[model samples]
Target: MSDDQAPSTENGGGGDVETVEKSEDHKKLVDFGLDTTVADELEKLFQAKLVTYDDLDPRALEAIRDFPIECAIAVLKQLLADSNLQHVNNKSAYICGVMKTYRQKQSLGEDKPAVTNGPDEKKLKEILDRTGYALEITTGQRKYGGPPPSWDGGPPGNGHECFVGRIPKTVYEDDLIPVFEKFGTIWDLRLMMNPMQGCNRGYAFVTFTTAEAAREAAKQLNNYEIKPNKKLQVNVSIANVRLFVGNIPKNKSREDILEEFKKLTEGLREVIVYAFPDDPKKKNRGFAFLEYDTHKSASGAKRKLASGRIRVWGSEIIVDWADPQDEPDEETMAKVKVLYVRNLRSNVTEEELKKIFEPFGEIERVKKVKDYGFVHYKERDSTLSALEAMNGYKLHEVEINVTLAKPANENKARERRMRRERDNNMNMGYDDYYSSYPPASFGPPPPMMRGRIARGGMRGRGGMMRPPAPMDYYDDYSGYGQGYGYDDYSSYGGCYEDFSAEYSPHPVTPQPPHRGRGRGGHHAPAPVAWTSNAAAAWPPWYAQRSGGYGTAWRGQSWHQ
Candidate 1:
């Protein structure tokens, strides 16, 4: 056939494109000489709609595709440079391990940056120097800073650091250093970066050689515009040297993490990984705090890892300066001025609790529950002062312990108690029976049930509550005690406020009488028997001792 008459390769766009891609994929699969079972299974899964897929996404279709050999070699060398690969024996094992890690990352639906297609180290450095961004993007963050060529070796003096905020994430050190240096020589200028997005976190810390320079920078650069319609917030700030390392493999132990990081970076002093108290395997929370010997070392490591050039444990790791969380955050402290005061003398009173904490701040409210109580302050600063002073202050011959009332626990507990209280109130049939009785005089409750009458919202022993099942919600603090009256509070002594307290402390609210109590009021005279359908003028002795609900026991008719 004439060339013009021949079927065009592009005659069917999708068919031709798919055929070419399949051919290329086949070639790639054949060249790698690796198993295609993973790819095949995924394809089958997609066909059956058992798993999600993006047909247009290359990773979805080529999940098991081979990488460029050159890129693979470069990565292997980098890994070897950072770690001892003795765990891996031969080329086959290495390749399998690498592919397995890659597959696992892909399975997590991570969008892999084109490490091979991106600029090389030199080109990347040039680009970072020019545009302040890296071509190879991944999750986590980075930091970049260096000390000025000054003489003093001591740390930045008090008030020598200023926080620069509201910065455009697009602007980096290349643009910021020159502008800030105009004030004075910078001791250290660290810009926080979000590597996943290849941008700043809109804040940085600029430390000057002298406190005067720091003040000058804050005065001049405060509200200075770095980008159109954006002003920087420059104010004195405290400096930190710890880093937050995220995206760590959950299986890695503290020892594994510390050892790996020590080799990759200098001056790594400690690795802090927190495990859930309830975790059986004690896996890390997929992140850790790394304390470096010096801020310089921490900054250097951040810069290196931020370059998108290295991976830890064959996985992308994120790094950023750690935010201090040993205490309540400012926002939380602002809202909750309540202090958790414990370790009090048994003789301590509500007045004593108030008197003790009132010296630090204006007292808002105070409630003494046995050996411990909570004092609410009108201001956070006052709460802080009280917290610091009274944490171990001696009161009544006992070292009083105090801390910020963690509203999270208190709030959660209050909610549960309120719910449990509602349930208990809803289940009390005898209270309804007593509250809805008529004006006709009823002799006191049956003689045998007299002293056994459950007090504090309990009428006929039905209000007897139980502690939360240990297997369900484990807690380290006392439970929220329910009753509010001083008499009840004193007797209960914050029992419900503490989980370990022996008494069940559900405070009952006066709910509308149950519908079964067809006629009811809040304060009605007690009657011996229900006018509508009394179970018995007097129940047998055994019936009063072991009563049951739903049959004249829980505000229901015995006949029904």
Candidate 2:
């Protein structure tokens, strides 16, 4: 045959003259035996524009830790299976941590058990009578001696925690805690660690019992020298307890949606889905909200989801903070006497909680449920007094969260929306971020109707497909949270052609009767005329003005 059909045999005597060239990736794919080629794909995605390590770093880890090469390869394979470079910001560094954890556990012979931090852990714990922190080597996030067993008041409120940056990698809590405790009870101190280097990632968060303490820390600690020349940068952090989730399946039900999220991560306290109003089948508008019990839990879940370690329906979903609702009106919070307190030390008694707050206000009663409890004050002033004094108050060494108690469905999002509308401030959309369902008074879904509109026929910017209320009373409503007026923007056929996830609902103009129809003398209102000034009245947060359907704002389709 011609040389074109030549066989490879560089090592042989004239049997074949050519040999297959094996690249590093080629050797890895054979040795790791993973089902995915994500690393290879990432290499291609970045290409010559950026350099990335697509090959395994297990050898370096094995070389340093004396861990078996086989185990290191095994860990590398698992990490690579779901490894999208977009998710793992630093693949090589992340692998280093995994190998370290595996080595520690394998040596202890506890294939899987609680974190035994070994030598470093032992030394940290030895410094105190009782070690309060736990360790997880796999993530390279370990806690040294933990928070004290208990504090005197409730957990801190928003802004009770502050960020500390520009840290030296070698610093630990032992060298930092004593200096900071002068401001208030230290609720939590977290130093981000890099397991590969056995050092910190150079930042930490210090949470105290009160916002005052946190602000004080930020004020006094800013640019304060922690080491010889390493000054710290501190800023009080706002607590974020909710996360925005996008690109979910439009066909999911409330129960179905919750189940999907519950399977992927924890601290999924609530899920909110926007449903298509006009569709009798009640499919969602394809986005939802997830609320967590604690900022820590929310942050953890965000990392897992954002890291691309989790997927919905076999597809990646979007994760970010929902538009922030302003802090609940101080006036509204000031009007209540009942206090909702959470994050109490698990075993603390109700009597103890009541007693802690009693000094600030006369207690009406105390209701305890698991780690959260409620304190009722005899008067509004007492309630306000207790909220200010006890919020972020530490009790039994556990920092508690104390705030005005709210009934189910009355979340901060709705409150802010209402306040914003009352001030005639700007165009406002209903942000039911805190509730999966609307207020109790929102009632049930109204009956569906064609040809007839409800007494409250509301019209909006052209082309928004709203759930149609009955033409008097023709079709019964079929879903929870679907009965509210003008909640979300879900376009249907013949409606807006340029809808986007970034789109928000606009103001509604009541439909006026233009012609007398059958029964009740109700008249069909004329279609609303879109105006240029309508967008000017939009809430300040909306970066783009509405120009009706087919209109482009900031390079995005408005209603479509």
Candidate 3:
């Protein structure tokens, strides 16, 4: 065909007739590594039902791409034969005939150089290989021969290995070996499994036969989709130096701890601070593990910082060699059944404390002393449930601090005893140590009263002295004059009238009746009857006064 008539597949159109482009389907075919010209022809064929549309699907395209052009033509011829349509009119006939003729010539003992195919044919073969489709056409059948070989011979892992993450859970050893074998010979393939479930744990380890093969696989397959909705993560597997760090401040972040430790040393690969798994903010858990690139660096860091001199967030942290195997043990340790309760009110009784904790679990015992105590539960699971439910809860009007109590130790026991003693001292009173008595006397008691002191004599009932009855001042004054009698004063309205009114130019207003102090110290109007009753309740001496009480006289009245 002339260059002009070769085909204009760029827009999925042919023979000078413009066609409505299915750009999305065309792009999908192209992404599967189909040449534009071939893809357009295949679309035409599928539209005409000359070839099943499913034959040109991504899976089919991937399979066909694995073979060389000659092999692929052979496979197509076999498919035509199987369909009993070997003579069907199609544009692919020329290539198929050429390959058939070549094979016949070879069968007849004639030597010929392999066909020199065009760039388009070469590109098609490359696409097929990369898509992981393998077709064996030599046997006159178009059957997939599994994925193409990664290497011609030998197992992988000669010098390199790769880490694969995000593996699908349904993937198995058989499923992985065949797919990854396309990249290179795999010496060892390990799909990490959940020990309890015996299923894939979403990751794998692949060791390739050659470093170059491993590198190629990692570069080409990183983020490569291996299954529907599951992509592979490929990374170089390196030896890691893990260091254990303890006593980390709970407020310190991974970045902060890394920054502080990085200042002390270099070559840190990664730093991971454990956190409360359920917390959305991921509060730190006061410990962490760090990875280094080399064991020497890790050992050096441990040697220099293990003395607890390396401080992070003003807290000296403990550093030591980390054994990965110990992780499970540490997790087991977290399932303790004892809880430490702090910030309790000193007056909280044991019964009250039991009520606070009994809702969580059956408490075996409660060892409470003053403001802190421990609650031992019947089961570890109950303790965990209670801890999660009751942490930072309010008890006895105080926000109690609750945590998993560490295993008891001698030092902790000593500390507790010391604290108890201190609390005891604080609660003690002076009455507990000394008896009370009257203060030392400064002089002798006063002498007894003299005989015949009063009308009742010196003593009365109950041997107690009694003061003489109040003298009848009214009677005594009554004899003085009729005007001095109490009744005479009462007749004058109890208030002393201004007797000096005649001496003054104007009669006195008799001063507005003395108002009583009201609520909030403000003076209020006094009732007319209250003035007379108040005057009557006053002492005998005050009733004899005239004019308003003076300031000096007021002081003397209060003294009296």
Candidate 4:
């Protein structure tokens, strides 16, 4: 054996010796002596194991293929003898590590190469595994768990196509068996059947052993019409099924409904127009759900509906608008108003603040309220500007809270209440003084009637017992009688006729309505004019048809 395969004596004599066996792993060397033959053999061995040499191309090593193993081994031994071979081999090993990493990365399919040619079975599995795609295995039934009626039990992994259609299950299984078996092993086959219908519905599911066989079956059978009395359509078993039944005419049967939608969509996967079990008599439930195997066919159905494909029976089919996810916008009108701010330092007056916000907008009105200690702005924008500028600015050791002003009506109501309270206080004080005791000129009651006797004595002793009257009294000066019941003015030289006229002993004649008017009744007609006008026009009618009549003509005549 060569040194490469030499037995080591590192282990002691044969007493269950502990041996240091040399690792046979390949190593890198900076210098390798010439031995092309052995190097080629090593390269082939690594290639067979799917190991790559980073520094050397696998294609380049192909030239040494015809060389004998003995010759290759000789070349490898010669290369290993060189001192610098170790360094070159180390470089090669480093490159190989990087290439191995890249190959592992490729397996992950991060940047997958396009698969133009159909991938084989193994490649399909690898792709599916990498992409988390499922085979989507399914049995022949509308819902799950119901088996095909004519189930001629087949093995697992049969190379056959599966689809959902309206053709009878008996016909689908009988016709599809021979045709699908042409490509490869038909491991499993099923024709989808409605349990209640008890017949094939023209749809089936099939599986094949090999992916290539399935692909071949799909390509050859798709759109190929087989006429067994009526033409039967075939297509690939695409999984993009959109099953929805809406907007069905109330008067359509299962067969009639399928026929209508079959004409509508080219690749009609399914068209079921059955009413609910509870209401079998009801017409079609007013809608039908359809399932299409391909997006193209579903979109085609939508296009057909758009082009007036609706048929009316008891009621016309309708496609409802989808409800929006977001609520509709509400519109509002903006209002502008004056704002009065309070709780400001009295030193920070109105004019100074108005100047601060003057650049932002027009300053309509600004006034300081020292009473309540606030600055009021009539303009909306000025208030906004002042808020924005001085909102965070420290004023009177506090940041100002600025916003739009409250309603002026509210402020006015508050002020009116305050003024009303002040007026009420003044009225209360005046009433108290006015309601007290009467003045001295009104006189006290006489000594109280208990002394009624003294009151009688005072009353009976009149003019003779009384002292002479003072000169201030001119009662007898008039020529009236001066007896006990008469006026004292008659005792003087004064005439009683003048006194009687002044006193008005005779009933006075009533005064006529005033011709000299004041603001009180200035608009009223004069007494003479009122009498004349009333007599002429009371309840009068128009003299001419076009002229004014009685009360209907007020301030101005209709003719005028």
List the global CA lDDT of all models.
0.47, 0.46, 0.44, 0.34
Score every model by TM-score: 0.29, 0.35, 0.20, 0.17
Error of 2 at 556 (Å): 15
Superposition error at 191 for model 1 (Å):
3.6
How many pairs of residues collide in model 2? 28
User: Once superposed on the true structure, which residue ranges of model 2 sit more than 4 Å away at CA?
Assistant: 1-127, 130-142, 145-160, 194-199, 209-212, 227-230, 239-241, 247-260, 273-285, 294-560
Query: Which of 3 and 4 is ahead in TM-score?
Result: 3
Which has the higher lDDT value, candidate number 3 or candidate number 4? 3
lDDT of 1 by residue, 146-197 (tens): 4443345655633567778787766765567668778876766666554333
Provide the RMSD of all predictions against the true structure, rounded to 1 decimal.
22.2, 20.1, 42.2, 49.0
List the candidate 1 regions with Cα displacement exceeding 4 Å: 1-170, 178-187, 192-223, 230-342, 345-347, 354-393, 401-560
Ranking of all predicted structures according to TM-score, beginning with the best and ending with the worst: 2, 1, 3, 4
Model 2 C-alpha lDDT per residue in residues 1-560, reported as the tens digit of each score: 33322322333335755343334543354345432233233223234323244433665423423545356445544443423233234445655666666667677774432222223333444544443433223255434323445555444555567777787877776666766777876777766766434567777777776777877888798899988988987867655665656566777876787887888778676775544433426555455667665667767887888886777887777665532222322344455566666554557788888778888867867755434556778888887778778777767655566666532223323432333234233332223221222222212123334322231222221122222221221011000011112221121100011111121134433232111111111111111111110000111111111111122221011211
Candidate 4 per-residue C-alpha lDDT over 328-433 given as tens digits, one digit per residue, 9 for 90 to 100:
1111002333333333454776666666656766665554422111234456565556656654454555444333432212232343334334433453432243
Best TM-score goes to which candidate? 2
